[model samples]
Target: MTSSPAVTAPAERVRPLELFFDLVFVFTITQVAGVLTAAPTVDGLGRTVALLAIIWWMYGGYAWLTNALDLARPGPRLLLLTGMAAYFVMSLAVPRFFDEGPFGLILGLAYLAVVLVHTAGFIGTSGHRGISRLGPLNIVSALIVVAAGIVPPQARTWVLLGAVALEALSPVIAGIGGFAIGAGHFVERHGLALIILLGESIIAVGTVASELGDVLRVVVGSVLALVVSAGVWWVYFEREERDSERLLDAMPPQRRGRAALLSFGYAYLAMITGVTMAAVGMKKAVTYFTTPLHDFELWLLPLGLALYLAGLAAFHRALAPVWEWTRLVAAVAVLLCVPAGLLAGGWLMLLVAGLVLAGVVVVSRTPGLNET
Candidate 1:
């Protein structure tokens, strides 16, 4: 009898290449947060989203590639390292791109080059079957990127926007086969990235509080921000991770591929969106407290909270059909507290943060919370 190829479990050990790739994402995250910080207006908000979407798509594509191929292989490892270097260049260009008129065009072109190199590497390493699967979409993406480069200055922005959309949709249209990378690795990497985002928020909050020179307020605000971050951590890592692993494992191979794509691949967009908004909100809160509440900052506070809560909701919904009442209540309470924070000033931000933590605690401890 012929022997079957060995099957690997979704919980198989993570490779070093995976970890190194994640380290590179740290720079991408930092660049994203910095861009938001530089220009925190409505127009800036749209640009930030486009930039982030492009970055996320690039990272997500490579992640899926590693999921299928053996990252320990020299070819894949080198490609990832090269992509990492390209991403760093893109990140460095972000600040200048946003600030200078001509620089934005240059940044856009640099970003396209990074995507092309990464995609080309994938195509080169991918064999006949893999190439056949990815070829058309890859061609389309490359064309879009090239087109973005040559577009008129007035139209360059929209061209780049369209390129982002094309890049984002490539995977779905490609229908590439799943590689079955360990769910644990996927979850852990994202968990670590989320921690980095929260860490950034804490750093931002601390900086703001210190500038105020009010010891009690700084201590309270810092503590509250920590609690908020903890709540976000608990909500994800506490039970959701295990449940998702179980669900993915129980699914048939074909269905599991789709599940992985939807869960790990797409859902992260919502999660990152929340983190970005929260970061902005926290910064505004600190500024509003130090000075008088500007109309814009007042709007930002609630809007940021809403985005964060919406992401939380998206995560739960994607994992399973069941919903926790405490999560619902917590989200609503956070929203309600937004106005109170505005009226009472910075203390209200702290108070809303407290409510968010309490809701997390309640949800985490709730009896008989059904697991998918």
Candidate 2:
């Protein structure tokens, strides 16, 4: 009889089941955004980011996990099923992600279950650097998330932030000695995850449109949000995703994991967070189209775009430094416009943010930005 081939499947394609598991995070991102949608305050926004970091860390594990696991086998396939179940249950608690309520406890427990599953599954696995050296650190970071739920809300934010930092930095701090990448699978997985998050923006449009009735103003606002999302898509997939994929495929095996760590693990975290934030802003803008802007509510779209751009730029810096400065400037410009957005009202501010991002996309096509 054959031994279990749960780990070290290098040539296998990403299976349909893996794609099916990804469905859960679509709702996961939405739930995080819904939390901010409800509050749209400084505190609410901070909590949303904290919650997103935790959620992203959990989702990210599978991306790296599957890159090493031989999911064609029963053991790994069942592991994924269990992880997805936990992911869905935890997503249900995302709205209360940082609230010091029973839901927080539930979210923590679910998240811990996910971490435990991955950590335990990877135990005794051979020749997987991400799982081998960095896996234990993932467990530690997840424990921080579990601890965060029990703390007061204020401290919960900091604890979650720590959890994100620890997990994101694990590659650098812990080093992925045995970590290797099946580049094709790794790239496809992360890219699909980005698409899923971008789809959240589209989902936001529909979700907002339905709530807003069929008014012309709402229609226009909805279109603008889609435009913003499309422009974001172009900025990323136009060159960045392709380049990163090429780079990962070209890298030597021993080094591939760290590069994946920097480019996909940490960088994609920023991108996913930014995309989710953009969805939150877009949803709120749907409401703001008819209503007037108040205080920080106006900041959502710009802030969202800024984070999204910043994430892109950070990845560019890590992989290809030349594009970094330009991306940074574009991100900062959006951020600088927040005060104007605060006063400009929702629809108008969204229009401004959308236009500015469109311009950034144009600039991204310049000769130098093609360095990949």
Candidate 3:
């Protein structure tokens, strides 16, 4: 690794190589959606969230790493590619993660490699000391993940959740004082990741809809799905992105570290979970557009969107002192559609969510409400 200090220019934009790295995240998101569709139950949801929490923690680490070090250089560039390869291998293991197979062991080894690459990259930056302390915790977490695979299938879920909790708390225990965040690059990196996920949402919808036998139904369902996805895109990009970056840039280093962790790291995890749920919901909506949804399917569409809106509210609250009442209220309003969806169908639920999100976009853009 390069011996350069961890500092990076605050004005730096995301690099092409960073975008390439995000393609792996795209695959990971797809894998997550697949997991949800296969199980579609409370247990499946728990596994999805736990698996994503662990994966996203390390993904955020790479984003922070790129923010601190320029990957245009040969050494950092190569290591990042190595990390990408390991991440891809890890993603490959995601499909059967909770199953009784070698994938659990494979995922553990790949995750360890990813952690090591991330730590090695950080050593070249100003955050080396802090990363040195945080790195072993991540390794131990990876080992815990491996152990989850070894234990009885009935016990794997708890083991994975334990790993998730450890990694989530590790940065707090290790301290973030030494790490430097390039505000612009950090914001842009995550923004791009969100964009990738949003696109995946659409992909999930279109892919599923197209597989259905009816062309007209496919076209209609695809259009409705687009409306919902576009509304989410508008809410996030319209002002949240700018406000987050501006607030982050304006903070002192110490506060910025904590703010980034809470706002981007933790809050975005919720948002991503919401997105994955909504995507699965939309896909199911397409599958059952004419018929009423049963069981967990009925809750997926509305509740998923509700979670996204609520997460956005939390994210705004984390960055600013004020509550985002519009989003919070909208989140609740979306949930009200669950009973109606059971009586009608998922398509109606999707339509109601799209309209609610549209209202939020308009209200958010209103004169006085634009204050961040």
Candidate 4:
């Protein structure tokens, strides 16, 4: 009697390495927050955006790699875990890199080392099928980052930005590869990451509110932050994710793969950019009265709100065929509230946040929007 080979499932069981990978991101988040806290300027904000963009690409790439490769094997799992450890070390060095001049090169080298290790493992375990698909873009991006490290200090920023651009472009190239991309898990991980970022925003709000000590300010700010966070949650998860799941499940595998790549890998850049900046905005809102709103702080609030709104709109557009009028209106309302919030002080900012939340709740409850 001849026996058939055991078929491994495409969606592998979540492993300890995946969990450890997530822990490294916690440090990544902290490093980013620390950088924002120290610099807190317009240049600082730009730097933070560039840095987060690069880190998000790194995280997203590895995530897709894990989704594609079977990590149940000891060799693959150990290599990935080691890469994650290297990533954690790189994350730890971010604050120092930004603060101390001499340490920047050390930090850059450390970060490159992590990327090299991960890239090598990704290529090795991905097999011919997967490697042939994403290999070229991966190789291109890895080289750019490595080359960026060799540039002089004055020229490093532009080089780093170029490296980041290369990394961001990898998904577009990878999507051209016709493979069974797991849409469900991809969306799930990003959704969870969004929640984690929002949670950080809430923590920032609470901490800042506690420092205020005034009952009225604390109460007002706390409520505003909660409402804003709730509005964000309502906007994304209300029906968008469900719709995406249905759409992908119904479509052909190749098109579904492209859609999943576009939605989770590309679209999420806007969402995370907004969410991280919103954390900065919340910090500014809490401290606006004591510290005069600098040009950067002034810009952060509106920019963050705009990015968040844009991301929501993009997600809705992708999920539903018909335009979401309510979402468009909500986005406009949020943008309009920023200047008014500036004029009325921190409490007013909180009030504006509440209004935005109310809009999301109303739209979420509107007829014909319910998931099947």
For every candidate, C-alpha RMSD to the true structure in Å: 4.1, 2.9, 2.1, 3.8
Q: What's the TM-score of each model vs. the native?
A: 0.83, 0.89, 0.96, 0.85
**Better candidate by TM-score, 1 or 4:** 4
Count clashing residue pairs per candidate.
0, 3, 2, 0
Tens-place lDDT digits, model 3, residues 247-340 = 8888988798888888888999988889899889888888888788888977777777888888888888888898878988888888866866
Q: Tens-digit lDDT track for model 1 on 1-372?
A: 975433333435456776666666766666776766666767666666766776776676666555545565687677767777767766776665544355555555556666666555544333324445655565566466445545554454466578677766766777756345456666666666677677777787788878878776588766766676677667777877777777666677667666666666566776676677666667666656533355454555455555555565556666667655555556566765456655676557756766775667675777775232
The CA lDDT of each predicted structure is 0.63, 0.74, 0.85, 0.66
After superposition, the stretches of candidate 4 with alpha carbons farther than 4 Å from their true spots are 1-8, 12-17, 99-102, 121-128, 146-154, 171-175, 212-214, 289-294, 368-372
**Candidate 1, position 191, lDDT:** 65
lDDT of 3: 0.85
Model 3 CA lDDT for position 315: 89
lDDT-based ranking: 3, 2, 4, 1
Worst 10 residues of 3 by lDDT: 2-11
Q: Which of 1 and 4 is the better model by lDDT?
A: 4
Off by over 4 Å in 2: 1-7, 11-13, 99-101, 124-132, 290-292, 336-344, 369-372
